[model samples]
Target: MAQQLGGRARSLQEGPGEYRLDNGQHILIGAYTESLGLMRKLGVNLEQSLLRQPLRLRYPDHEGLSLPPGPPLLSFVRGILSYKTWHLSARLQLLARATVWLLQGFRCKPELSVAQLCAGLPSIVRQELMDPLCVAALNTPSSQASAEVFLRVLHDALFSGRGSADLLLPRRDLSELLAEPAQQWLRVRGTQIFLGTRVHTLKQAADAWHLEISGAPQGETQCFDQVVLACTSLQAAKLAEPWAPAWAQAAQALHFEPIVTVYLRAPGSALPAAMVALNEGPDAPAQFAFDLGALGHAPGLFAFVISGASDWVAQGLKETGAATLQQALQAFNWRCSPEVYRVLAEKRATFACTPGLQRPGIQVARGLWAAGDYIAGPYPATLEGAVRAGKNAALACLQV
Candidate 1:
């Protein structure tokens, strides 16, 4: 049971308008095997629902790092060498760092932040690639993001398989991509999905696990044999506190970072590519922008996403929106004047994936498991992380 239909990944309508805005722009790399595999299993047409392309940090005016089609490692090497934007020494510095990471099998000192790991690289390389990639993947700045987690993401994307480095951008609404289809898939299999339902408390009993529910017409209690808590870390912590105080504390101890998505509307405006990486600065609140028109969505709609946006959140949405508009204006030549359409911020969008941060494990109590992106795992807080955690919990519950 979930509090919301999509649980942080859904589309919402603003001002009763026909157009819907997503909480933020989400990008899935080809390395997200469990998530992609599950979507395929749910009968989601991968080709129709997603736009796949070789991962490249393409800027507005010039090409940045564009990986060619070939073996993963070779493509990475070639891509770095071919990009003339960086001095050859800067490129070699990146390659040297990567070689060291690979030799170490992508493992690092647990306490090292991503910034420190890439500190020796050229400033241009850090600014153009590592910093943005670190924030996008971990939702935490490189200075605080975990080096271990970042390396793992790199390993999976660049060294795992052929298409693992490809970027998979959503071509449909967020709900249509996964949430709604997943709900439908479960309903046909005789699973009862209780939307707008809340499990207030969980109590252990001899025969089964008794759940103290809220606003149930029949009663306030429900029974289950094996249960998996798939709600947010806060909700799961409350229910699991009595059973597993240590686990609950760990879940609660996690710090979070916010993400802001500023949607801008420019009539008949089109971007050079489907996605463009912007130069984030003191005034620029966005790191990446998406041409929704190019992504098979509405025409002339653009999403400017600011990951790790604590500073922007403090500045207020009004200021953030205005700054984002100015940034957009400076970056591209618009068909007409672009206006701030909407600014959406997820305060607790993702946990601050800092170095040495601890997360709660899946097992909470006897025959009861916990699942969410916040669960302790190799990966950071992502759809792939959440899906894999849920899948693992399901498999574990099946064993019992």
Candidate 2:
């Protein structure tokens, strides 16, 4: 929408060089139809940009789940029935619970947590599958995450259509893959981009919105018929304080969860799979690990991600990174000892997706709207949710 509307977006780091170095790694899925569509519109070659694979969760020693290609329901059933990691009775229990959820239309009360919803399932299933899936999707522990949102995500990925459950790993940096392409696409359409600019205040005047922006030579005030605040929840709250106090309060009230990504480099070594699920605990903090070499990046470059990482962050990035390195060494086989390259932590990676949490809607006020993953939406804070919110905000602006 920024591209179509002829405006520029800013970043703390310039270009795809230093910016890419600091950005967190992200993964997408075929279920993110809106994000894929937007990428296609921006001229990204999906086939080349993403390495697609069916749902597979391989761990060290090649122990985990991998669904085969087939009809969604059949594949799910077959995968569960064929799982050898758990006892036959446990698999049957999972299948029975799945059948009940399907028969009940995946409906659950708004206040129900994922742990509560899956209370009847085998502990092994909850530990290996449900816990990891919950943290990955909602960035909240299963004990606190909303069950309704979890079911919605599962419905879209496993039952929506073919390939929906497939993972799309980016082969390059995020700016090169999406942000730069989007900026270039917008530039061709005569959009005026203001790099290094920040908006100090946003106010309404009669029928238009006014923005007082800085960070540019000769600060200027701009006016627009409609405005979309595509920024962090806190920044949006600060900007909306004058016009939307209720929205600001709600935004401020929302708590956040952290994510830590630790990069380890082991020359001449590679993981068994492109991605692997790790047994997270006090010793092993990472929930998932990615082998960048297998995904077309530098050989032996591995990324260990710790979602819902508040405790790890408190321990310090360096300490966390060293501990994760030890965890990787013990978990996987390597040609050589791996060294810690960098540890990236986003303190406020996402709003805590807790059960019964109230998020503010997109429409903050008349002629004002918000476009962010944190806004009230069916999905949690994901790339697809942000893209969907942007598209919705664009349509709302057009309608006005």
Candidate 3:
């Protein structure tokens, strides 16, 4: 809508080249239809840009779950039955729990955490699947993550459609994959873009918004008929505090979780699959690792991601990176010794998706809206949520 409404989109970075040197790795599933539609609309060739595969979570030792292509329910059943890592009784217990959840329509109490919801599951299932899945999907540990939200995600991914459980792994940098295409699409449609610009202050005058651009040589101010605060929760809170106090309060009260990405370089090294689930513990901080070589990046460049990484963040990036490197060496067979390339940590990567968390809604005020993953939504802080929120906010603005 910003592109069609004759407004400008500002970014602190000049472009993807200048910034985003090492952005956090992300994955998408077929369930994210809105995000897929947006990408198609922006001229991204989904088949070329992403590698689609059946849902497979292979651990370092090559033992984990792999759901084959078939009817969603049948595939799930066959996968569970074929899983040799867990005893038959454990698998049956999981199937029983899943059937109960399905019969209950995937609904759960808002106050229940994921850990509580799956307390009866086997330890192997919890350690290898549930724990990693919780952190990967919600960026929050199972002990504190919302059970209702997790169940919803599971329902959408596994039961929504045939290929909904398929993984779409990006084959290039984020900018080349989506951002650049989006920027070009907007530019072609006459949307002005202000790169390396920051909005220092936002003031409402009657029905319009007055924005003071930061770092402007002559103190530039711009007014807009409608405004969408598409920034971080804290930034939006600060801007909306004067006019939308209630919305600002909700935004301000949101607590955040951290994500750490450790890049390791080992020439001629590779994983059994594009992505591998790691066993996170005191020494192993990374819960998942991506084999960039298999995903079309520089050969032997692997990205180890640690979600819900508050403790590792406090331990210092260097120390955490070193520990992750050691963990990688011990976990996977390497052609050569791997070393840390870089450690990227986002302290406020996402709002902590706790049970019954009160998030600010999209409507900040009349003629004002907010578009971000942090906005109140069923999904967690994911690319799909961000895209859906943006589309919803744009449609809402049009309605107003």
Please tell me which predicted candidate would have the highest lDDT against the true structure: 1
TM-score of each: 0.98, 0.94, 0.94
lDDT at position 198, candidate 2: 85
Shift in Å, residue 234, candidate 3: 0.5
Model 1 per-residue lDDT tens digits across residues 1-400: 5444787888887666557877788899999999999899988999999999988898988888989988878999999999999999999999999999999999999999999999879999999999999999999999999999999999999877898999999999888888888989999999877776789899998858999987676589989999999989988998899989999999889889999999999979998899999999999999999999999887889999999999999999999999999999999999999999888999999999999988889998889899999998989999999999999999999988
- Which candidate model has the greater TM-score, 1 or 3? 1
Candidate 2 TM-score over all chains jointly: 0.94
* Model 3 regions more than 4 Å off: 1-21, 215-219
Q: Write the per-residue lDDT of candidate 2 for residues 266-294, one digit (tens) a residue.
A: 98998888889999999789999988888
Q: Report the C-alpha displacement of residue 370, candidate 2, in angstroms.
A: 0.5
lDDT-sorted candidate list, best first: 1, 3, 2
Over 159-250, each residue of candidate 3 has an lDDT whose tens digit, in order, gives 77888988898886676767778889989999777765678788888778999886544457988889999888998999899989999999
Computed on alpha carbons, the lDDT of every model, listed in order, comes to: 0.91, 0.85, 0.86
Prediction-by-prediction clash tally: 0, 0, 0
Give the total clashing residue pairs for model 1.
0
